[model samples]
Target: MRSGVSRRTFLASAAAGAGALAGLLPRPLRAQDKTVKIGFLAPLTGPVAAWGKPGLDGCQIWAEWINAGGGINIGGEPHRVEFVAYDDEDDPAKARTGATQLIRENDVKFVMMLGGNSWPGVQPVAERTGMLFSTLLPSDLSPSTATLIAPAEVHPIYNVTAVDWLAANRPELKTAVICAQDDALGLPSVATYLAAFEAAGIEMLDEPLLFDPATTDFAPVVTRMLSKKPQIVCLDTCYSDYVHPICEQLFQQGFKGQILSCTLDFYDQVIAKTSAEFMEGTLFQFPDFDDPALNADFINFQKPNEFFAEYNRRHPGQWGAVSWEYASVMDLWKAAVEKAGSAEPDAVKAAMTEGGEGLHAFGKARWWGKDLFGIDNALVGNWPVVAIEGGKARIKEFRSIPDWYDKHGELMKKHMAAYNQMWDQRG
Candidate 1:
């Protein structure tokens, strides 16, 4: 690993050259000596780029802010933060290469991943090196993977909160049909929604309809789902690429009912494709950072409204569910590094999960998920349930995830088992 501190003599050399010369240097100049590099391995190009690129933008803002504030103080010495990024393009082979390169060649203390299709490729390398890594997907956690953590977003597990909120508010919607692409993301979400619906007393019209990832024609999928005459159409964790096309087909077909999804990114575009009336009342997770609820005391992102503004200004119409997630993970990481007094991967990992507790973006949360994922690496707490009211995504409420888990955890485990999604069951 590269040394964080620059090799420049200060107090000793100055003392020898002239008495009391060291005190003359400006404070900022003396503090700007060391650099700490972190790795960002995620897709910058491809179907999932929306989930990856905006995160990079947010991290850039975070690094700049930390540096401006004289960097993070580590054992009384401040070190400038730097991010080294690689575009994995959502490919497993490329993910493996990127992970190895980031850890071996660049020597990053920690790596952040978008964590879906490419995680399997990166997992072995991460385990071999004992590199501290953060993923947005808690599904990626397992007991064997000690240094991996899902500190920010918990993905499909959080989808339950939305369903719980929906059942409470719109209890009349009974039957639902679901469809998703056959992949790492789609399957687990299908299981989660299945459990949520079952717990909510919403009956399924049919088994989950799995489509190929390369499928372009959503007409058949939409037609089949609508044929069941279900009141709710669940797009169980489909990619943004798939969500738009399926939603367009649903709108074009004029099969009107509630639409539930894990993310409705760039909903403005979807609203344009479909009518505002058609998009209204749609339920999903992930709130816009500028939402008034983000100002709540439980919220941790600094000036979330300003961050949202800057993101939109720089990368217009591109922010999505994962826009701020990577930066939030960075927030936890920075705090842990400072507390550990070192950036060594092991030390940081220990500090991060010091007491099986963490400051999740939403609020104070505990490390959980041993029953579902066979590991307690996920930070479980309150997650928001968002609905489109007048074509804008608004947080309806902050639902407690642990509370939901407490009520229906066994049902969730049964559904996950049906899908063979338990960590030990995974290869």
Candidate 2:
């Protein structure tokens, strides 16, 4: 408050209730003074349900927590938030339609999306409406586009940490082969993994086995990747919908070597399907909230362990890529909004930029990148390299991404070029 109100005092005001956002919400969702609406667009009924719905469910709990705590403060009042979810079903056209409905019909102020083609589909609507958009995939980022951001899961940039940790620790694991769907998120990740493997001096055996989204059976794909017999098999940003089948196939095929991927969700189910031993050496980017390493430096990681315990108690036996992701974005956004003392998209965006090297849930980090996603705005920094330990995923190390970019910047370019996915050609 320029009125001499302390930051804590202002937040305390917002924490007072939904009335904090009295003038902020769109006309429709605003009723009495007790509610604010947010849009959760994800692949709800599609093959990607494991990745999408469960994550939105996490958002439900986040909203509940905030509301229970009073609500979010915009300037000096409390606004309890509500999420209005729409299932885009992972289709670009459906994503566009869902976004339009969310803004025009539901009147949501902030729209959280699974953010791939869905991002591109919904961007125009966001631009026209001045809605703040958050995406998990930084591939949606561009300088011309002002609203979209990847604050939580910075996709491929974070993936580099996993491969780096693998190379240094498991030095004997030399050769690697990769497989992933050929799309905006998948292809960039594959390119990054190829570059990371090169930087780590881990030979990429095959030219990267890519599959189509229409592929429901992962057996053939797994068979082809295993044919390379590389010490490690990299699953490059595959949707959990695909990860499960591929992992099951890998287990069936008896792949005993190191397995590296961007995510491993519904891990208990995967263990039930593939058994505990085979899934033991798996390396991934996202980690469980219960990890002790998270307790050290992350602020928005507020009670991630508590969140995990609660989520397990309620939903039990289901978690996926998007889990904790959109919620993490909210945590970052809250800090930025508080820093700016406003919720206007441009104002908040400026505050995020001014913060300079903002620290996210993974600890201290900077937001810098243009060599890859064509926008330096995507938050880049230390990412934890998670590995399976005693049947539970744990952060083995937090690796430096800027260091990797320094060493193999051009290698990443070569791989991206090889796949013809230079972000310009992307939709």
Candidate 3:
């Protein structure tokens, strides 16, 4: 693996070459041939790499597409986009180091993070540097983190849409068992599922089974969850590493039930381990961009079908929940930079939330989260409910997350408090 300095040097060289080529064009066309760097500070080589590495890949495509046309227009000048990535390995101390380096050395205008345990490490740096940052997890938001935003992928909050869809469509499955690794990512999702199940009137078969992250064997865990004879099994945001083996155990134990989760990343591998028949009808929150639903008139993402095909061509069989999230953030950031007529963090952020709403990947969503995160920084709106059928993932429906919150917001707060997951409690 290349050192951080080496990677930066390579990217700088590539950016210089691109700029040189631009300079060859007519003088009027090369009005302002400059480069803007964005920071990808996340776990690129760890248990969480599934979420981070794929996102950087997608951002690469996004930058190529934008630069091929005309780069982001700021103050009537075009600036090429480049990415500088630093792997935090999901460690807080490493995250802090990465954030400082990306800001002071790389001079990134924006930074995107997976943002669970890593947020704390980056928060202080953001406070000090005033650099704009975006997180996939809205649970990381707080009133003090003014420069931080949840422009895409609301994480546990969006999990409610899946439960809502399940209860309305398959009401027969009234009882559920939930299991998750007890950690920053898992606990909040467990609370969200609890609130969602409660709102939908589905009974939790047992106290959520919180297991240690290091536990390699899942037989005993699955045995305990199955002891209650639940008609539904909810895997509350476990890492793909854990989700896959637990699924294999469910199949080995000969259990047939409706399986729900926050993600089914790399589900094809799970199907291979078990069987396609055994993996059918599993419900999760993310959709493959190739899904026709993304082409709806209200959807804001550009060229979803082509993006999916290009992504698969470049990185075969590596798509996951975050494959497009960071790229999606870039889409919003580019628009904001253009709208504000500058790439400065403060100006771009002001433009992003100027009207109290933003263009989410699904549609226009309100800038909300004050009641939950003690800050109105998360872009809340509709989220998709997906199911695996006939060996492929399909978007079953796009459900309103804001509508669900309006109906059960208090219930969600109660559950979040119970699990010490509310913003205040976390602080």
Q: Worst lDDT window (10 residues) for model 2?
A: 5-14
- Lowest-scoring 10 consecutive residues by lDDT in candidate 1? 6-15
Cα lDDT, all candidates: 0.80, 0.72, 0.83
lDDT for position 46 in model 1: 64
Give the winner by TM-score. 3
lDDT of 2 by residue, 271-352 (tens): 8888888889799987776788877855446666766666556655543444565666777776677677776677777887
Number of residue pairs clashing in candidate 3, backbone atoms closer than 3 angstroms, sequence gap of 3 or more or interchain: 0
Model 1 TM-score on a 0 to 1 scale: 0.90
Give the per-residue lDDT of model 1 (tens digit) for 150-249. 9888978999998898899999999999999898888889999999999999999999999998787789999999999999999998866778888899
Minimal lDDT window, size 10, model 3: 4-13
By lDDT, the best candidate is: 3
Clashes (N, CA, C under 3 Å) per candidate: 0, 7, 0
